[model samples]
Target: MSRRSSFVLAALAGALMLSACANTVRGVGRDVGNTVDATGSAVRDVAH
Candidate 1:
C-alpha cells in the first residue's frame, strides 16, 4: 500500500478508538450518577 493510504488507515483507526473511549467514559459517568442518586434515596428513606 502507498504511504498515504497507510496514514489514512491509521487515522481512521485512531478516530474509531477515540470515539469508543468517549462512549465508554460517558456510560461510566451515567452509571456513577445513578449510583449516587440511589444512595441518596436510600439514605432519605432510612431517615424517614
Candidate 2:
C-alpha cells in the first residue's frame, strides 16, 4: 500500500478508538450518577 493510504488507515483507526473511549467514559459517568442518586434516596428513607 502507499504511504498516504497507510496514514489514512491509521487516522481512521485512531478516530474509532477515541470514539469508543468517549462512549465508555460517558457510561461510567452515568453509572456513578445513578449510584449517588440511589445512595441519597436510601439515606432519606432511613432518616424518615
Candidate 3:
C-alpha cells in the first residue's frame, strides 16, 4: 500500500515536470516563429 502510494506520487511529479518543460518549449517556438515571419515580411517589402 505504502509502496504503491509512493510510486503514484513520483509518477505525478514527473508528469507535472514534463508538462511544464513542454509548455516552455512550445512558447519559445511560437516566439521564434513569429520573429521569423516578421523578418520575412520585412525582406519582401524591401525587395518591392
Candidate 4:
C-alpha cells in the first residue's frame, strides 16, 4: 500500500480506539474524583 493510504488507515484506527477509550476514561476520572473526595472527608473527620 501507498504511504498516504497507510497513514490514513493508522489515523482511522487510532481515532476508533480513542473514541472507545473516551467513556472508560471519563468513568475512571469520576472514580478517582470520588475516591479523592472520600479521602478528604475522612481526613476532615479525623482532624475534627
Top candidate, metric TM-score:
1
lDDT of each: 1.00, 1.00, 0.99, 0.98
Better of 1 and 4 by TM-score: 1
Q: Candidate 4: misplaced stretches above 4 Å?
A: 1-17
lDDT tens digits, residue span 3-46, model 1: 99999999999999999999999999999999999999999999
1-48: candidate 3 lDDT, tens digit per residue: 699999999999999999999999999999999999999999999999
Worst 10 residues of 4 by lDDT: 15-24
Which model is ahead, 2 or 4, in terms of TM-score?
2
What lDDT tens digits, residue by residue, belong to model 2 across residues 1-48?
A: 999999999999999999999999999999999999999999999999
**Against the true structure, what is each candidate's TM-score?**
0.97, 0.95, 0.74, 0.60
lDDT of 2: 1.00
Regions of model 1 farther than 4 Å from truth = none
Clashes of each: 0, 0, 0, 0
How much does each candidate deviate from the true structure in C-alpha RMSD?
0.4, 0.5, 1.9, 3.3
| Runs in model 3 lying further than 4 Å from the true structure | none
Error of 2 at 12 (Å): 0.1
